[model samples]
Target: MTDDVQAVHQPSDLRTVIMTGASSGIGAKAAATLAEGGAHVVVVGRNTARTKEVASRIGGTAHVADFDRLDEVRDLAQRLLDENPRIDVLANNAGGLVSHRSETTDGFERTLQSNHLAPFLLTRLLLPRIVESAGRVVSTSSTANLFGRVRLDDLNWRKRPWAGGWLAYGTSKLLTNMFISQLAARSPIQAYAFHPGFVSTSFGSDSASMRVLNTLTGGSYGISADAGAVPLATLSGPTTVGVPSGTYFDQLKPYGRQAPQAKDRILAEVVWETSSRLVSIPSDL
Candidate 1:
């Protein structure tokens, strides 16, 4: 942990939550809710000022790292491991919709790397501590996953033309669902993915059309960010809530409709293996 990172003093028994994307939208709201409920929240975001602001408001610790770079993700993980004795819940809530096709410094498609690969790496690196704490992993997925198609051969989008990035975004969410399912199957840690509904957030603010639509429609088009955050905060709670491991939720409802590829166990296993290889982690971990 850095000296400048604000640390909130909380009860030792409080659950330690690491909330990514806590600088804004559903993630920020959910992190506040968790903190109010007496959890020790670790706020992670790409924007330093925004991340620290949220953390300061919630009396939580803040760390900033851009998901576009794998090195930053690794550094964030190490800082997390070094500071927290246990991580009870990891809310993989940091992701966005890229409007154009681009590759990160890590050499993976920007959307796929930011939304899936980065979270994948963070979870795997923290697996041991999370398992030791008998923790849970809750990811923010989407109904857009219904349109996703994952091709193992073209995971990097090197061979296919980008369909304006929605396809890539959907594919990343599908990978999220599959990763949760496979993680639950292979490990004792409870893992879940959920669709937060069409939230009125800056999710697709990278696109000009989306910005215009959001401006014109406002909150009428979708639920508020706090409303969309309810499911995430709920699922982040105790395991006794009866949500089974590997469940994909549409808001609060379990077993939400998922794409065929998202539910295929064999394909999920392959995805797990391939993602592990891509991120240079152990497949079996």
Candidate 2:
């Protein structure tokens, strides 16, 4: 495992898992599987009714969080801290693609903020709990990461004209990969990010064009939501899956060919630094 020049944290049994985007799609399916496997699953969704319904079905705690709102994410984190003293896995699975670029009230690009910033904040805020339990952080990433182009000068996409959602979404996933890699390198906590393939879920619902694209291409080729969920669940804990920490996966197999930026230590540091500033946290933490 030359790719894994860095050592990994000690593995432990997984008992409780907190998963976002559990209202539907891969998140929802993973929730069911984890619960059945005897892990206490925490379900976070954007919609209230759907979240509760899924929680009820899985017998897991439910929290509503619109990733576009940083405050909501903070609140969710605090609530989880109060209830769950120790979490085994923090699966950052909540994210989407919008046809056009938008900004959150926090004044950041919606896609990046939702997909990357919110999860980074939650993970940082919950670092103590994760360390106490020696838990792993598994994020839902994508193969689009190979083509990611993030502008360190303009992460908000304010100066860069809206070039459509594909690039923005890819950049977000790339950042996720970098975030996981940096965290693995700097800390003893275990972390992994994965690509779930072209899952047949309402992934890009916010965009009309995405919906049309899904309708056209998804029907014949898209994998079922259940199929996509398997990778996250496999990586959740007790993995015979064999992918090392700080590594990205194409579905189940460890992929050595990563975007050059994803493996750049300097870029990873930059992403982490910028994320710390944006999340209103001290970098020293």
Candidate 3:
């Protein structure tokens, strides 16, 4: 058997967790670990077969929906909420870095749509259930946010030409941070952004720019997917306390000052408003 199929503990009392990008990488590892911890994890991904495989092996349910597709993400959230109103955790982990400039069916930038908009929409859609259950919302961020620059004028890369995938990817992370801050202020759900610490995942191998970065670093800088899952899993635990909402973390250690762009409330609100218009949710939901 592959090493990736290693057994982990399941969540006992933590019965419900909605994990996106559960097909592979840190998301998959986190889903397995949480399932082993006894949580009835709902795995969401673009690929049905792989996500189903992970869910089946972990004794959890799988839901297939592409985050890059806003309508799909919206539908996924509604269906998930309908299936189980007791969802206790929302792990917004699905994201990607397209090598070239692209847009989703919603006409939004692919990275922004997947990493920011979809998560934003899904969280808003499922927030009532999460808050009803007094659950936490954990979104994945990266150290790349440190170097990210938000091009507000050209958020879609319409004005500026495609520089590289990393630039757009980094900006998306920054947007995530900004959104988290707004959530902390507005939502009852504890919101946070975490750096999984240079994860060694297929994402890097799949992108030419990341491949070069990985090779230059001799792969020494990357952490195992399980290692990255440690801190994420911690946030989902019941014993965790005093976790400052909107804070950034790296392996249980609190990291700070992601980037100037990440603190732009105006940008965050703009993104939030734009996202709200894209998805249809009940007035208080």
Candidate 4:
């Protein structure tokens, strides 16, 4: 362990959890569950009012950040480091499905940047503290990963024509799994990625097609947000609960089926290296 980890040691019962995207949907619900279970939760979201509301309701702290911008993500990480001594869990759950192919101010594809690269930067920035605390990293991946195909050379989808952005969204989820796998391999901290089921939440609200599909399903095609958050809460808790590191959960089941590409170690390393450059972080981190 590093000096940073040793300086902020606390009892196991008083775990400090940092959950991104906690303003609504499964993230908010999971944050509440963790708080109810006695963890000190730090709720991070894009919207100020909603983030503050969730934090106040759960007796947690709120920090607002837009994932589209890497600088904001860095600031969020710095603030987290300054405010907390030890971080027991870092939930990389803030992401969305964009309606069209667009680039963020950071010059990366919107979906890829928001979903994968932003969280990647945050995790790398906070790695030392988390490693020393023996913390876990939990991410919200998806069944959409099955539809994903990652072209390591063009993660931003610049060369391919946008097919209504579903492919981009799917690829981002696949990247989530690869990130967890690589982090587990390289670090001492436990890492997990899970599919929360097809959840009926405000997710994909920006996409008209997704909205139409959700309306047509009438909430029948998926589970509720609260229901979808169970695995997330479970994985992020203090206890390891017998699940090995780097396991991807299909809902609640460990070692769930994943896209063959998601399991390719070489490809995962490539993603790590590529993402490190994209976010201007050290690849070894």
Best by TM-score: 1
Question: How does residue 24 of candidate 3 score in lDDT?
Answer: 90
CA lDDT, every prediction?
Answer: 0.89, 0.83, 0.78, 0.88
Model 1: runs farther than 4 Å from truth? Answer: 1-4, 7-12
As a TM-score, model 2 comes out at 0.91
lDDT of 2 by residue, 33-84 (tens): 9999888888888887888888889878777888888888888887777777
lDDT of 1 at 68: 91
Q: Which stretches of candidate 3 lie over 4 Å from their true place?
A: 1-14, 213-221, 278-285
lDDT score for residue 212 of model 3: 84
Candidate 4 CA-lDDT value:
0.88
Best prediction by lDDT: 1
TM-score of each: 0.95, 0.91, 0.88, 0.94
Query: Which runs of model 2 end up more than 4 angstroms from their true locations?
Result: 1-14
Per-prediction backbone clash count: 0, 0, 9, 0
Q: List model 4 lDDT by residue over 1-285, tens digit each.
A: 001111133345568999999999999999999999999888899888888889889988888889988989998888888878889999999998987888999999999999999999999999999998888899999988989999977888989878888899999999999999999999998999999988888888878887788789875668899899998898888665577788999999988778899979999999999999989878985
lDDT of 1 by residue, 1-285 (tens): 222356444454668999998899999999999999988899998888899999999989998888999888988888888778888999999998888888998899999999999999999999998999899999999999999999998988878778778888899999999999998998998999999999988788778767778779864678899999999999987546586799999999899999999868899998888889999988986
Prediction 3 TM-score vs. true: 0.88
Question: How do the candidates rank by lDDT, highest first?
Answer: 1, 4, 2, 3
Q: Any runs in candidate 4 off by more than 4 Å, and if so which?
A: 1-13
| lDDT for residue 266 in candidate 2, whole number 0-100 | 90
